[model samples]
Target: MCGRVALASRDAVKACAGVDRELTSPTPLERDGEWARAGGRNASPGCAIAAVRIAAVEADDDGASARLARATVGDRRACAIEDVVWGVRFDSRRGGNFERSFNARVEGLLGGDESTFAAKLAKTVNGRCVVYVDGFYEWREEGPKGAKTRVKQPYMVRRADGKPLALASVLTPEKARSDAVDDFPRREAAVITMPSAGGELAWLHDRQPLFLWNDRDFDEWLFGDWARMARERRAKDVKGLLQWHPVTTKINHAAYDGEDASAPVKRAVEKDAGSVAALFAAATKKRKVDDETAVQID
Candidate 1:
């Protein structure tokens, strides 16, 4: 459901993850300042990838200690800020392509069909990670379903307090082998998604990314046994955790990157609305559902 996301600054990501000073930036960012700058804005797979902070136990002079490091979606090495590919590659030996593995369903990861390749990998390897993003984009379909005249209105979802959101994700080595000769093996990551049964943002889509906004939540997701943890926390409510506002349609075009690409634009229907609170209230009350389903945390 999370097709596009906007990342925070490099320093912000490091601060959020509490990265150690000894850790260094990835090679790509070290050689190119522009690439690092672009990471602050809306990032699409292949063109730009968000930095992920990972924590692991390593053997050192002190025996075993937990350390914080960085890795992109598909980096094969450890303790380095590796630039991994965005989409999860399918194993070539299986004769399938890496087309739709970018987003992993929360149900699948939390004890679904284990016969699939992704489910098997998720169960075997604890590839837990925190994806730092300023916000994300979604679309709401207008008009009747399956109608030819249906139009999708773009919306930008972000914290109501305007802080960075730490999204929980799962990573895996690139499934498909690349022909290009690269020094490191490619890797890919998928944002874990849950059913958006109830929320202000439910109007936009039926699924939303699992968010770990605080330190305690992040620690549980990153280090704890998430499958068990998710079951225990399944009753928690996530409504009003985020706010969604209609944005310019320019975000639909991947090539379009204007100053207002991610900015909230006045909705044509509510152009004369006097205040933002009124607009948000209207959206919240538009489709009142009493039986709001609880969000499952994983």
Candidate 2:
């Protein structure tokens, strides 16, 4: 589930967006120092970070086109990159009391089930967006079953060609009561994830972030009919566009930041191959016995 991400700098975001003018809003800069310390490290949920999106702009004769913009949430306008909160919060009336809404499943979005959390956002034209990230982290577990313990072997997933990945995302404004005063909406965003059924990195996890690798994909993702687009293509089918490798475990600590945090590292094996094989064999034998006991009870 893409719980942690590394953001490109403001300049890198602009480069990806292909715009020269400053796309980030100035309001976030006026905040306290803590707020300013939001981006460019281990960006977890609730942290302020940079994202790229296309906002509808009015043209001559009331026509509009989707123009790329750096997006953040707290600003009055949705045109510039601002320091918005990461998770999308639904209205209390909607019965969405989720502790975290940072990753929206692609299946939930395109399942055509109106009851799903992402259904409404997926059908909306302006709800679509592309989040720019240098890379993201995922954990791989080791050891055997039952007695096995999961160790987070952090891995950095990035584009194979070294370009930044434009991750698919959805956005929404903070829910407020209809009669409430001073209830300005704070915009929030969430990354979308797809299943990793048959990919090389599937061993790391069963899910990966949905991303747009090139300009054509980016345009269709941000400006096309998202519901139809999602139905026609699955993100897992495009898994070849990304590459994943083991990285330092320092990323496990949210506060840890340095070049080494994302640098590729060799996996250090604590147990020899023989010991690992033995552990697996023992675990398999115990599992077979347990299954036989369960069948007899049934």
Give the best candidate by TM-score: 2
**Residue 245 lDDT (model 1):** 79
Per-residue CA lDDT of model 2 for 169-203, tens digit only, reads 88764445453223222556788887776765677
Best by lDDT: 2
Model 1, poorest ten-residue lDDT window?
61-70
lDDT tens string, model 1, 1-298?
Answer: 5577666666666666555332334424211321222343455654334445342433332212222322222222332233444556554645563354667777776667887554654543335555667788887665457766655567888887777776767766444554532432255667777777655556677887777767666656654456765544431366667777788767777555567867878763354345567878777776443224222221
Q: What is the TM-score of each candidate against the true structure?
A: 0.68, 0.70
Alpha-carbon runs more than 4 Å astray in model 2: 21-23, 26-39, 57-83, 90-98, 144-150, 174-185, 270-298
**Lowest-lDDT window of 10 residues in candidate 2?**
67-76
